[model samples]
Structures are given as structure tokens and as C-alpha cells.
Target chain A: MGIQSVQIGFKHICIMTTVLIALILFLSFICLIALPSPKEIIESLKSSEMIFSLKLTLISALISTILVMIVGTPAAYALARFSFFGKRLIMTILDLPIAMPEVVLGLALLLLFGRTPLGTLLEDIGIRVVFTKIGVVIAEFFTALPYAMRMLYSTFETISTRYELVARSLGYSSFETFMKVTLPMARSGIIAALVIAFARSVGTFGTVLILAGGTYMVTETLPVTLYLNMSYGNLGMAITSGLLLLGVSFITIYMVEKFGGRKI
Target chain B: MSGFLIVKNIHVDLGEFKIEDITFIVDEKDYVCVIGPTGSGKTILVETIAGLHKPRKGVIILDGRDITSLPPEKRNIGIVYQDYALFPHMTVFDNIAFGLKKRISKKDEILREVKAIAQRLEIEHLLHRKPTTLSGGEQQRVALARALIVRPKLLLMDEPFSALDFNTRTRLRKLVREVVSEYGTTVIHVTHDFEDVWSLARKVIVMYRGRILQYDTVEEVFNRPCCELVASFVDINVMSGIVVFSNDKTIVRVGDIEIVSKDRVCEGHRVKVFIRPERILISKSKPVSKFDNVVRGFIEDLERQGNILRVQVRIGSICLKCISTPNVLGSLDLELGSSVYICFRSSDVRLLVES
Candidate 1:
């Protein structure tokens, strides 16, 4: 065969692989939605257990995303802007949650909150974390922080330091320059990071399951609800929870697609 | 001692590029242009003075105040980069008003000051547009207005006009000259373009390998460079010759050609001779003038650079570069391998140290 035909064959194979995988995923989602009658799915969604799980998931993800942004933005900026001692080590530690298995991260968190002195200090202050509702937010926060920070770091890196110099020459302090120039230029990136962080927080299952105990009707989130109903062989409730998580994933992908590119 | 700004023994180590013992002085309202090749530490010197990069060892005294350890915001120095570096998110009006807001609180006062500078820069109509929406020249004017509105003690421009077309650069040069004079602002402009030095510089600083080669008046630096490197940088011809005496006049014999000089040096002593390229006059035939040094040579190479044609003339073993206009080349009908007579006056030759 000639080179042109070989190149064309390679292109077709790659494209065919992509299409086949995408079609399989689409058909799987369709099977989940079509397995149950519409009336049964509606009833499962309106049930008290499903309602509590959905509310808890949304609230915990919201709180965790906000907390992640608050701590991650400055950390990412520091990583992107400055060169200091142990920066690589700190970055590797931050990326551990993203690279290691979610169950491993959850186990580490379990030991920290259950058997450590810091966890006991929090209990003394009446701020319970382990096996509590607050534990859900804590688990989600740790799970989502690395992705948010990675996105924000790249965003801050794409912004030239010359803009900050120009602002400084105009008599603004360092903090003032960051607020006026850096933050404004990073608007789209921050939005994309928030969407991804919220999505990651809401989809967290293993971490929340291990640390928050995944108790039914008390600390249960949407993912936890899916797991609990699967164990009880409640197919209607399990399929409904899976559908809700899929919807959140689609919205998150759309929002991120709208705001991912660098604007300034 | 009467200098307005003094940089004393500055040493900076930036790993890739460093400046050692870099020192210079600028009088008040002097437009100093720093010209050098790429990676010659031109930008680092300006950034150090702007307090963006602190020198390892140096003292920068502006207006009799030592701003060595001060932050950029506290130094009262304004800098305009080659890229303009305008806040892309802000309107042109807000950009010009940014520095003014730090000094003026009221909105009306800020508006008035911004309007005044914007009108002076002829960018008043572009006040509502973002920097990314404006043209290159328009964005540069906005940057200049933003820097000048605050009435800084000194302005540092790092090749601010290098990004524009020739016509726009010429126009902005004139605008900057007029506006800077009106504001009485001192400027340190770093550029690689010779036109910028000729048109904008009152004093020129020639840098090479992170060291100041020559810092003097523009005329002196162009006409009488101190060293061979400075001479080459300013497009001056540098040749080594031995001092010879003939008819009670000091002359230098360079490669079988004897050229007289007004400067006195001991006979039989080796010396370096310098001559400006534009000072050398080329002719199709030797003229009747006996006072000037005239020699016949063949044209070795011809290259056109903009309006000027750079002709390399071969005279024996040495090659002399001659600058002539294209019109002159056309009129003289000069071509490769064409024989020509080159003449230069004795007063133009200056003798310096050996090698």
C-alpha cells in the first residue's frame, strides 16, 4: 500500500475507535433511563429519602466548592508566580488526591479525623467532622481541591506579570494589583474551575462513603443514595439517583466548555 | 554631582543575563536612549531602575532620594513596555485614570485629569473602547497617557515604538517628544533602532555584554566613539594602523593607504583609527581635490537596506563599508566589480589606543 492509503487507514481507525466508545456510553445511559417506567422513576425522585439525599448533595457540593476556591486561588497564584523552597514537594502533596485512588485518600482522611489529636480538638470545640454531615463537605473539599487548583494555576500562569508591573508603576500596592488586574483577567478561568470543582465534589462517592459513613436519610448524598439502594435491590431509586448525577455531569461539562479558554 | 538620577555600581544576577558594575548618570529632563544587541541586559537595567528587579548591589538615587530598596509603587517611576501592557479588561478611559485614582479621590477630578491627558494624546475618542479593541498605535498612546498622567519623576520605555509600523512609529515619536517636553518628564528609552537614538535621544548609552561601553551626548557618541566596540555598534569604521609623519603632518598608514589625521600621536607608535561610514564619500572617478585622502577600489558587495544602499568596497586587503542612497547608486551607475574612488577628509579621522 502507498503512504497515502496507510495514513487514511490510520485516521479511520482512530475516528472509529472514538465513535464506538462514545456510542457505547450513550447506549448505556439510554438503557438506565429506559429500564424503569416513567411513573416509577418520578415516584422514586419524590420520595423522602431521595429528596433528602438530593438536597444534601447539592448543599455539600456548594459549600465544598466555595471553600475550595477560597483556599485554592491564592495557593495556585503563589505556585504560578513565585519560586520558593519545597514548592515542588507542596505541589506533589496537593496532587496526591488527584493521582492516588479515591479510596486511599478517604482512608487517609478517616485516620486523620478519627484517630488523630487534631480531630479530637475539633470534637472538643463541638465541631464534629467524622461520620457527620460536616464530614461530607470535608471529604468533598479534599477530593475537589486539586483539580480546581490545577486549573487556576494554569490560568494565573497565562497572565503576564507585565500587567502587574504596569499596575505597580501606577502606584498600586501588590495586593491592590492582584485584585484589580490579576483577578479581573482570570474571570473565565475562575468560572471554569468553579464548575469543575462543584462537579467533582458532587460526584464524590468513595471518599464520602468512607469518611461520612453514608448513613441512610441522615448523611446520605445522591451518590451514597445510589449505593444504598443498589444494596437493597431498589432498582427504581438507584436508577433515579444515577440519572440525577448524570444530569449534573452534563451541565458541568457544558458550563466548563463555555468558560475554559483564556479570555485576557 | 549635579545629576538628577544616579545609578552607582549596580550588580544584578539573573542567571541568564547579568549586569556588573553598571553605573550611569542622567541629568534632569534628559532623554537617554540605551542601544545594544539582543540579550545585552538593556531591559534588566531599566527594570532594576524601575524597582521591578532589585540589584544585588547598587544604589539608585532619584532626585537626591535613595530609592534603592523602595518598591516600584513608591519609586514614582513610570514604565511603558513594548507590548503596551495595558489592562485588557479596562476601557481606555479607566486605564488612563488608573494612576490618577491613587492620587485623586473624587470621580470628577479623576475624569478631568484623564480627559486632559487623553486629549493631549489625541485618544479622547477611544476612551470608551477596551485596549484589545484599539489599534496598535492607539493602544500605545493610551499607555503613554496612562504613564504620563501621573506626572512621574522619570519614564522608562522598553522599545515602546518597536512594535508599530514605520509611519506609526514616526508619528508616535513626534507625539512623545512634544508631550514629554510639555510635561518636563525625564525618560530612559531602551531601543535597538538607530532612528530612535537619532530622533529622540539627547544622550546615548551604548551597552555591550551588560556593561556600559559609552555614555555621552548623541553627537559625541555617534562622531567620536571611545572604543572599537562602541565604534562598531554606532556603525563607525575602526582600523588599526601605525602613526607616521609626512610633511610635518601626523598620518596613519593603514594597509598601504596613508590617511592624515588632526589628532597628534607619536610617530612609529601603533594606534586605532576611527571614521564614520557616512563621512566617507564615494565617487566614480578621482576628483581634483588634493587635500583629502582619495583611493581607488572595486565594489565587492552591494546590499540595499531601506533607502540606503550599503556598498562594500575592496581596497587592497581591507574592505571599507560605504553608505550611499539608492538615487546616488542609480546616478553613478555603480554595479558589482565596478571601480570607484573613495575620499574622506583628514579632520574626520581620530586616533585612539592600540587594538
Candidate 2:
């Protein structure tokens, strides 16, 4: 074949592959939609077990996101601004969870909370974290901390340190300068990070399932509910939870793009 | 009077360049210009005094107190950057009021001070507008107003006018001079423009390779540079030769040419000669005076740089560049490859110390 014919043939093959992928995705989406009408989905969503699971999922995720922000702001700021020994090693270890599979992370957390002296000490203090409501939060936190930290670190990095210096020169102390200048500058980034962390925590499956044991109504979140119902052959409840999770993710991404995609 | 602000042997090593044994003193309300080429640690030097960069060695004393270890906030020094660096999110009024709010508690007083300074800078109308919405000159005025509203003990500007157009630069220079004099703020401005020195500074410090080469009055540093390096960096011509005694005066010879200098140098001692380009006069024929230095050379090139014309004449291996007005070139009918007489007074030939 001539060069032009070969080029046209390659373009045709590329279009065909793209169309095939789109077709498969669309067919799967249609199948998911055809499985339930709005009335059936709403009925399943309003069921007592689904209601409890969804409420617990949202509350635990919100708490986890707040905890992540409160603890991650300082950690991310320190990583972004300061140079000290072992910083690179610390940064690499912090990012390790993002690279590792969530199942492995779940197994590691399980061992730490189930088999370690630290876990026993916490249990003696009446803080039971294994297979409880608190366990769901702990699992979500472990899954979401790295993403929150990365987003916040990039946010702090984008801001010039000169703003703080200028504030300091204006007769304000370091803490005051940060409160007045740097925090306001990084507001949008912090919001975006909160949304992402909350979304990640809500959808967390492997970590929550292993640590919280997918118990019904007591420690079950939406993902755990979906997993439990799928194992029990309750297809309607499982698909309803899946659709709810998808809706939450779409809203979170839309809000992030609308507000945080511009300058910090 | 002797100790307004003293920097005692400050040393900082940032890996690329370091300031070693740099020391200077600025009297209160002194206008000092630190002139140097790029990457000469000029910004580091000023920022060190502003308490932004902690010196690796030595102390910074301000107003009879040691502020070397103090944080930038406690130093009370205002710094204006070349980029203007006004907070993009804040309006001009808010930007100017930022420092004032930290000091004064009353809102009316802050408004009065901001308006007064803004009016002085002729940026009062831009008070409600964000910094990004203002023009470059307006933003610069707001930056100045913000820095000055605080009435800082020391004002440090790093090439503040380098970003503006020529007319705006000249206008801002005049405005800065007026505002600084009215405030009587001790100022240390770092710039590469010689016009900043000529128009604003009473004292000039020429820096190179992270060291102060010459620190003296503007007249002293311009007329009497210390060495060949300072001469070249300052764009002055320096020739080295022995001083020969002739007719109750001394003459310095470069190659086969002899030129009389009014400045006294010891016979048999080598001295560095300095002359500014604008001090020389070019003529088609020799002038009437035979005592001054006059040389006949062919004009190798003529270039009009801005409003001034640069005439290069070939005299042996030494090519001397003289700056003249376009009117002077027209009157002399000078062109390339034409023989011309270059005359400069004996008093204009400065004999500097040879290293």
C-alpha cells in the first residue's frame, strides 16, 4: 500500500477501536439502567438497610474528610515549605499508599489495628476500632489521607512564599501572617482537597470491607452494603448503591472543576 | 550620626554566589543606590538588612540596636520588589492599608493615611480597583504608597522602576524622590540604571562579584573610580601607563601617545587613567589649545544609541568610544573612516590608584 492508503487505514483502525470501546461502555450503562426504573431504584434506596448504610457512609466520610484536612494541612505545609533531613524519605513513604493496591493497604491496617500493642492499648481505653463504626472511619482515613495531602501540598507549593514574607515585614508574626494571607490564598485548593478526600472515603471498598467486616446496619457503609448484597444475590440493592456512589462522584468532580480549576 | 544603620561584615553563602566581608553604613534619611551587574548578590544584601535572609556571619545594626537575629516582622523595614508584588486579590486601598492596619487601630486614621499617601503618589483614583486592573505605572504607585504608608525606618527597593516605560520611569523616579524626601525615610535602592544614581542617590555603592568595589558620594564614585574593574563596570575608560614629567606638569603615556593630566601622580609610578565618554570633544581639525590631550584618529564607526551618538575612533591598538549629541555630530560633519581630532581637558583625565 502507498503511504496515504496506509495512513488512512491506520486512522480507520483507530476510529474503529474507539467506537468499539464506546459501544461497550454504552451497552454496559444501558444494561445498568434497564435493570431498574426510577420507582424501583427509589424504593430500594429508601429501604431501611440502604438508608442506614447511606447515612453511615456519608457521616463517616464527612468526619474522615474533616480529620484529614485538620491533620493534613500542617503535614502538607511542612513538606512544601521546609527542608530538613529525611524529608524525601518521609514524602516517599507518605505517597506509598497511592502506589500500592487498596487491598494491600487494608491488610496492613488490619494487622496494625488487630495484632499490634497499639491497637490493644486503644481497646483498653474503650476505643474499639475493629469491626465497628469507628473502624469504618479509620479505614476511610487511611484510604484518603494520601490524596488529600498531595492536593494540599501542590496547593501550598503553587503559592509564593513572598506573600508571607511581605506580611511578616508588615509587623505581623508568622502565625498571624499565615492566618491572614496564606490561608486565604489557598482556600480554593483546600476546598477541592476536601471534596476529593470525601469522595474517596465514601467510595472506599477494599479497606472498609476488610477492616469493618461488611457487617449489616452496624458498621456497613454504601460500598460495604453493595458488597454484602451482591454476595447475598440482592442485585437491586447492590445496583442502587452503585448508582448512588456514581452520582456522588459526579457532583464532587463537577464542583471541583467549577471552583478549584483556576488559580489558587 | 556615625551609626544610623550599620551592616558589619555580613556573609551569606547561597551556593551560587556569596557575600564575603561586606560592610557599609547608611546615615538616617540617606539615599543610597547599590549598582551592580546581575547576580552580584545585590538582592540578598538588601534582603539581609530587611531581616528576610539571616546572614551566615556578622550582624545588622539598625538605630543603635542589633536586629540581626530578629524576624522580618520585628525589623519594621519596608521592601518594594521589581514586580510591584501588590496582592492581586486586594484593591489599591486595601493593599496600602494592610501595613497600616497592623499598626493603627482606628479605621478613620487608616483611611486618612491611605488617601494621603495615595494622593501623594497620584493614585487616589485607583484606590477601589484591584491591582491587576490597574496599569503598570498605577500599580507601581500603589506599591510605593503601600510601602510608604507604614513610615518604615528603612525603605528597600529592588529595581522598582525597571519594569516601567521610559517616560513612566522618569516620572516615577521624580515622584519617588519627592515622596522619600517628604517622609525622610532612610532608603537603600538597588538598581542597574545609572540614571537612578545620577537623579536620586546622594551616596552610591558600586558592587561586583558580591563585593563593594566603591562606596562614596555620587560625584566621587563617578569622577574617581578605585580600580580598572570598577572603571569598566561603570563604563568609564581606564588606561594604565607611567607618568612622565614634562614642563612643570606630569604627562601619562599610553603606547606612543602622551597626554597631560591635571591630577598629580608620582613620577616613575604607574597610574590608572579614567575618563568619561561624554567629557571628550571631537573636531575635524586640532583645537587651539596644545596643552590638553589631542589625538588624530580615523573614525572607525559611528552609532546612534538612543538620543546619544557613540563615535568610535581607532588610535593605534586602543579604540576610544566617545559619546556626543546628534547636534555635535552634525556640526562636525563626522562620518565613518574620516580623520578627526578628539580633545578632552587635562582636568578631565582622572588618575586612579593602580592595583
Candidate 3:
């Protein structure tokens, strides 16, 4: 009943909660990795379908991440720096994908690129988005763009505009200042964002499933591969795909930890 | 009309701090210091002149060119902040060479210029180190070298010595004066430290509530402040009274005390009296002298501000502030509630109309 005892009790509760969750996750991962024999897992990993899925996932994720960074960095900088007429509305729309369900975002994107006039105009230009390999990249880009932009926006916000002003006063134009000062200052943040965007793009499942159709050996990524094989009752292939996705996650987290704290 | 830089009726509204109808002129190579309390829009005024913020309505003409709408890069102005604002990503050498590189593309020329400025600022050894690794004084020297390497048309410094220690500030002040004089660069320094004004400024601009209260030579602003706000800001005591005697000396009676001023005034006319605290002398005993005013009062308060002690003495209803050194306080053995005589000569008091 004493204050010290209660404080000790609260600390124990926090530590217990963290340890309990970590233990459960570790046990679940063990169960997944132990579902099949080692030889069967190796065979599943060497399968043609698994190879195609792994290659597709990496290529699509890389393309999507590059596209996201190129488009989102300026958007986030604008949101952090300038005041426009519809800034609030634009910010809300940009953040909508992060808060909304991924399947819903996929459905909205499907409608925009499939049935709308803009979709028809794109089809006239001989560009097919839905139910194709391009749909995988498009889905991943949309799924990861908001997270990358949110990260970059806070990064730009933390940097004082005074640095940019100093550069401008030192005979650099606005764009030149951005390149020389602002971007270098945000270097670590940009690296962290890139890691997160690549991770998010590789792990995107619902959007890819709904838009890219999760086609076998054609548009399937690792997550889609796991889903498809699980439906077909192939435990070895499903577990192998899960293991590969876990490895990618581990690498991305390692990349973030390695490069996130580097000083310019 | 004869000034090198003319700021005509400029208005700026940044929502938090608004500057209204500010107009001032700076002659070429004049070292002007802007002194004001926080949130007085001194920074905004300099930024507006530096082309960082466009004034809502006014004209800024520098060297006979209307540069009101030009960008900061096009204006060729250099600014140094109190925090240094040095680029953390660049080395001290690269930071000093940044502006020079923009003008001259050759790498060797840029190196020569950066080294010259670095040597002038006494920061040659710090060229290879990052700004974060250096001390505050060192970083400020680097910032000065960066700003001065370009030989800017006008240099604006926002309390550049505020973050440094007393010794470092004194050294940097000497260095800044020497370097700025050698370059003949016009400077508009904004600071809350009066030492900067006394040591560096030939002209002082006192701003209050987003408006400039007075702009004149340092002696005039400190000795003969134009208004009550300027008087208080310059640490001069302001008292209102009616001129009761207007002959050989003008005697103003406030409450029960009569103070004499050397300035001429009409009889029975209302006026305001300004007296500098350092000009008044405090004593424990009544001194017989040819002094114009000697009043008996009790010490209301005593405050030690650095080397000088500020004593507030209350005579009847009015309290006058007087400045004394710690040595004087120790010798006189003054404390709160100690009765004392305050003496000031008539010529030390400046007067103006009450309107």
C-alpha cells in the first residue's frame, strides 16, 4: 500500500507487458518457421514460382520506393514550408490513405484507373494499370507514399528555415539553397524514409491483392505468394514465403537502424 | 535623400510581430545598432531590408536602386544570427567559401578568399573542423568569416555576441570592428546589450511596439532622448512637473521636490525632466556644494547588476534611480531604508514638453 511499492508494481507491469508480447511474437515466428521439414522448405524456396515472386517483389518495391521518394519529398516540403489556399484539404487527402483501410484505398485506386474518364484516357495511351504487373508497382507506390511523405514532412519541419535563409542571403537562390542546405540537413531523415517506404512497399498485401489480382508467377509478390499458397493448402510454400518476407523486414529494420543516426 | 540606403515608410505584418510605417536612412559605412526589448520587430526590420521578408508597403532603395522586390540572393546582403546559423553539414572552410564559390567558379580563387577571411578572423586553424565541434566563439568567428568573405553591400547581425561569454564577446567585438572597418562594409546590428552600442555604434535606433521611437547619434539618444519611452530605454529617469521658476535656471516642481535644469523654459509651463542615473551622486551626509539639486531620501531598493549597483531612493512620492559601483556601496555602507542625499548638477538634466 506504500507509494514505493505501487511504483515498483507499475514498473513490473510495464516490463512484463513488453516481455510477454515479445515472447508471444517469438513463439509464433518459431511455429511458422518450424511448420515444415528443412528439406521441404529448401525445395519450396527453390521453386520457380517462389523465385518469380521474390524477383517481382524486389523489382516492384524498388520501383515504387524510387517513385515515392521522387514525388513525395517535394510534396512534404511544400506542406511543411508554404501556406496555400487548400493546404488543409490537401494534407487531409494525403493522410487519408494512412488512416483508411488498405483494401479501401485499393478499391478507390481501382476505380480511378479502371472505370473513370482518367482511366479511359490512360487506356487510350496504351497504359494498362489494373490486373497487370504495373498494377503491383502502382499499388505499392500508393500504399507507401503517405508513410514516406509523413516521415519527410516531420524531417523538414525539424530543420530551421533560418538555415535556408542564411544560404539565400549568402548568394544562393531558393532552389540552390534547397539543394545545398535543406537536403543535406535532411539526409538521415531521407534515408530513414527510404527504408520505411521500401519496407512498406514490399509488405503491401491487400492493395496488391485487390488491384494486381495476386496472379500466380505473373504479378505475385512474396506476400501475395504466401496468401495464394496458403489458400491452396501448401504449408511448405506458404511458410517459405513468410520466412522470406520476415527476412526482408529484418534487413529493412537493420538498414534503418544503421543509417538513421548518421550525422551529415 | 543624401543617404546610401533609404528605407521609406515600410510596413510589415508577420502576424506575431508587426512593423508599421518604418522609415530610416543609413549612410554608407555607418555602423548603426538597433536596441529594443524582445518582440519589438527589430529582427523583422532587418530581414525586410535583407530581402527575406517583403514589406507590405514601402520602398527600400540601396545605393540608388529600388530593391524592395528583389530576392535575398539578388540583394547581395549578408546576415549573421546569434546562434551562428552555420551549416552543420559543411566544414568551416567550405562554409566560408560558399558565397565566393558562387561568384568565382575557380576552386583556387575560392580557397584563397576563404583563407584570407579565415586568417583575418583568426579562425585559420578551425577551417578543417565542423562548426559543431568548435566552441561558441569559434563558430561565431566562422560565421563572421562566412558573411564577410563576400564583401556584402550591407551586413546585418542579430545579436551575434549574445550567446558568447563576456570575455569572448569583448574579443569578438574588437575583431568585428577591425574586420568590418577594413572591408568598409555597412553594418546594421540589432542587440539588447548597451555595451554593443557604446563600443560599436555611431548611430542608435531605439524601437518600441513595432515602431522606431528615436534614431540619432549615440550621445543624443542617450543624453537627450526624444520621448519618455526612449528616455526609459536609455536608462534615463523621466519625471513630469511644472516650471515654477524660469530665470537663470529653470526649476521644475514635482510633488514636494523642486529640481533645477539648465535648459530655458516658459514660466508655469508643464515639462518633462530626464536625468541619467550615473550623473547623480548619492551620499550618507548632506554635502554643502554649488550643486543645483540636493534631496534627502531613504534607499527603497538596492540591486547589483554586474559591476554596477543600482540604488532606488525615494524622496517623498517620487523615487529616483542612481548608479554606483560596488566599491562605492562598500565604502558608503548603504542598504535598504538607509537615509541618503542625492545630488545632481542642473546641466545633467534634459527637458522636453509634456505633450
> In model 1, how large is the Cα lDDT of residue B280?
87
lDDT of 2 at B65: 84
Q: Which scores higher on DockQ, 2 or 3? A: 3
Under CAPRI classification, how is model 3 graded? medium
Off by over 4 Å in 3: A262-264, B244-250, B264-268, B286-292
Residue lDDT tens for model 2, B1-355: 2578998898988788887788899999999999988888898898888877778998888988899999998998998988887876678899999999999899999999998998889999889998888888888889888888899999999999999899999999999999999999999999999999999999998888888898999887887888767777778877877888745567988766887888888788788878788888889987997538899888998999899999888888677879988898898887899899889989888886475
Q: List model 2 lDDT by residue over A171-263, tens digit each.
A: 889889777887778888888899999999999988888887778889899988888988999888988998889889889999889767747
**Per-residue lDDT of B204-301 in model 3, one digit per residue for the tens?**
99999899999999988998899868888899888889999999899999879999999999888899888899999999888889787999999999
Cα deviation in Å at residue A210, candidate 3? 1.1
Model-by-model lDDT, in order? 0.92, 0.87, 0.92
Give candidate 2's error at residue B266 in angstroms: 2.8
Q: Model 2 — TM-score against the truth?
A: 0.93
List DockQ, one per candidate, in order: 0.88, 0.63, 0.75
Which digits, one per residue and each the tens of the lDDT, describe model 3 over residues A84-142?
89999999999989998889988888899999999899889999998899999999999
Q: What value does the lDDT take at residue B137 in candidate 1?
A: 96
Q: Clash pairs of candidate 2?
A: none
> Which 10 residues in a row give candidate 3 chain B its minimum summed lDDT?
B346-355
